[model samples]
Target: MNSNVKVIEEKILSNNWYVLKKITFDYRNQSGEWQTQAREAYDRGNGAVILLYNADNQTVVLTEQFRMPTYINGNETGMLIEACAGLLDKDNPEACIRRETEEETGYRIGEVQKVFEAYMSPGSVTEILYFFVAEYSKSMKINEGGGAEHEQENIEVLEIPFKRALEMIETGEIKDGKTIMLLQYAQIKGLL
Candidate 1:
């Protein structure tokens, strides 16, 4: 909580899926003058993302899904390749990521290394995304994971060579920010 700001009013703008609120506040500027401002913030809750890598195989596991926002914004097919991720509704970051990984990738990984957390779209969405990396082998696969049918998620799992995955970035094939960040992290740390 910054002492430099005070909430004046808050109103719900929309309550369809998550929550959208319009908040008016009094902000103390650098010059020590108080100014009134208003902003709309969407609270979709925090989430967790993970990159599963196979050091022995020099491969990485990723997911492909259709994103409506991308479709409306100019993405030709609206299908995006990204690291496995899910919202932390009531579970902790680790548990949420574990469940998401199994549901999306068919990998029942045992150990995971947390990398970092970040707010992906701070300007409008209130979501802190926790990031992680884990080692995986063929033996870890338990089922043919697509996604939860109840949630209408149609996710596709992808396993690509670490080097080829990097090339996809240059070719504009993998455009998701979290996926790009995780891939770069792996490269920097020499995970593969």
Candidate 2:
């Protein structure tokens, strides 16, 4: 608890898969006045995302899946192209990403490099995403990774040329924020 703010009350809105809470707080304004405000936060837990690339082939691996939220918003098909990602369910960022990559992309990557972390949608979602990148080779392709069926994730793996992937970003085909960030990072660092 910060000295500048006091949590007055908290109410749990939902506790289905994760949690959602409505909080009321009294914050010390810059003018030295105590202002009461309310906000709802969705805590689905922190997660990790990774972009796999092949330096020799100048290619990158991505996944496509249906995202209900996007469908309800404006996306016509609700299908989105994204990097491999999963919630950190009692596992560290590195381990979680490695498992997700294999489950989503079917590539058992040997090593991954932690690039950065970001709080995506911090306004109403308390999710801090760990970002990573790794070099992938043909030998790493082990299983037919379409995500775990028990979790109801039907993902399509895509191996696209680096230049074409970058073009897709400009064309609005790949609008996923995490995937775009990692792709841009790879381009900037000459990791293609």
Clash number for each model: 0, 0
**Tens digit of per-residue lDDT, candidate 1, span 16-92:** 99999999999999999999999999999999999999999999999999999999999999999999999998999
Model 1 — which ten-residue stretch has the worst lDDT? Answer: 142-151
Q: Write the per-residue lDDT of candidate 2 for residues 128-181, one digit (tens) a residue.
A: 999999999999999989999999999999999999999999999999999999
Please give the lDDT score at residue 104 for candidate 2.
Answer: 96
C-alpha lDDT (0 to 100) for residue 126 of candidate 1: 93
What Cα-based lDDT does every candidate model obtain? 0.96, 0.96
Q: Look at candidate 2 and give me any clashing residue pairs.
A: none
TM-score quality measure for candidate 1: 0.99
All candidates' TM-scores? 0.99, 0.98
Full-model lDDT, candidate 1:
0.96
